[model samples]
Target: MPRYSDADLLEEIRRVADVADTDSAPSLQNFRDHSDIADTTVLRRFDSWNAAVVKAGFEPNDPQQRIPTEDLIAELQRLREAVGHAPTIDEMIEQGNHWPSTYKRRFGSWAEALDAAFDDINGEAVFESRAETEPDDPGTPGPHVSGETLLEDLRALADELGEPPRFKEMVEHGDHRARTHTKRYGSWAEALEAAGLDPDARSGGTQQVSTDQLLADLRRLRDELGRVPTATDVVEEGTHGIATYQRRFGSWSDAVEEAFEESDA
Candidate 1:
């Protein structure tokens, strides 16, 4: 194998850190496995794997940094401005300055952190906004929609689209905002499950299929169709569905190629 440059190693570390679970601190083994860079190389390059991770924009693996609540709120606002909308948990985890789990821990949940951020941005308390926007009757559904109602809306939207909408699609076209569902049900996938749909099929929450299972499904589709399976075909016919394959392998074409390679082997 060729020797990796320092810049190349750092870039790979950042790539791995970007997708790793935010709930846990990243390790040398994580960098090694995800980047194909040996742990010895990382340690030799930066004196420690944590040093390399720090250069990659991840929080240091020392005593967990206690981000001030005000700073967390500001980071949320910054993300909202950058994205032109309220940031989702996944968005925050992927793009925000702080970890999504940190925000959740500081505010008791991601929804509450968002509420605080929104309130700070609008210069009012959450209840004040509720008072201004909500109807007189507590029973009436308004901006602060209940979890059950949000689930119903999700089902209705799915029915309209013939499949569950991704988070961006739901934000652009659905009746309720994505933030509303997250606030009510903890995450969109949770809301989706509450609505009696496959959560993995809709939101890219957790991987519902292993790599072996996804490859098997892809091969099965190929055998049945006698050709490569498109994303639509996976959505309509595959066992774990299109979202599962997409999450596992990045895209339909990638999944098809992987399946073919496995079959050839």
Candidate 2:
């Protein structure tokens, strides 16, 4: 390779740090796996690999500090619940305690990590067990709705709930079953998009979210906490992401005030 500079080496370390899935700090081996530049080059300029890592602003990696497989899965499930969908790498970073890299390290890959989580979540056979209990087509007898009608219902539900509809929300509150949506659009996220709604990506700043929804979720958090909730409470345990509230209401304080003001009213 052409002669690399110290800046190049350190930057590569930071680059790997940003994208590497592990929550633990990047190690020299991680650098090797990702970089075209040599580790020896990193070592030649710096006293030690970690010395360079510090310069790049990464904490030293601790191989011993491993998160339990079960904990990782549990956090993934929590993330899914919080966001109302499968957890993504970015979601994991934002809400999950463990890093995606930690899952990759523990489960051999992020895909496998998600599979293990999905299996564990669905009790080892999400489809098989649900199939045993529920009918193949849960698109059961309801007022027949065309795709256009479904979109109308979805938009209507968003207006009613003050947020975009989730799969469960649609099943419970809208005129159609969740199955009908997936049948029409192949996924709930797509269904929301087809309805001209965002998939809570306030997660999809895109979080199902509106002032009323945020207030309800905050009230739920308050009941759980049994005290006034802080922003940390909302982020750590509330139904909606804290950022969603901020985006919707201009501040976490404003969101909480709205929730409580409604209760007092």
TM-score of each: 0.37, 0.28
Candidate 1 lDDT by residue in tens digits, 53-167 = 7887777775235456778889888988986766655455435566565665677776677777785443234434544554333222343345576777788888887777656
TM-score of candidate 1 against the unseen true structure? 0.37
lDDT of each: 0.61, 0.62
Candidate 1, superposed: residue stretches over 4 Å from native: 1-24, 27-64, 68-127, 134-143, 158-173, 178-192, 198-243, 246-265
CA error at residue 145 for candidate 1, angstroms:
3.3
Off by over 4 Å in 2: 1-60, 63-164, 170-196, 199-244
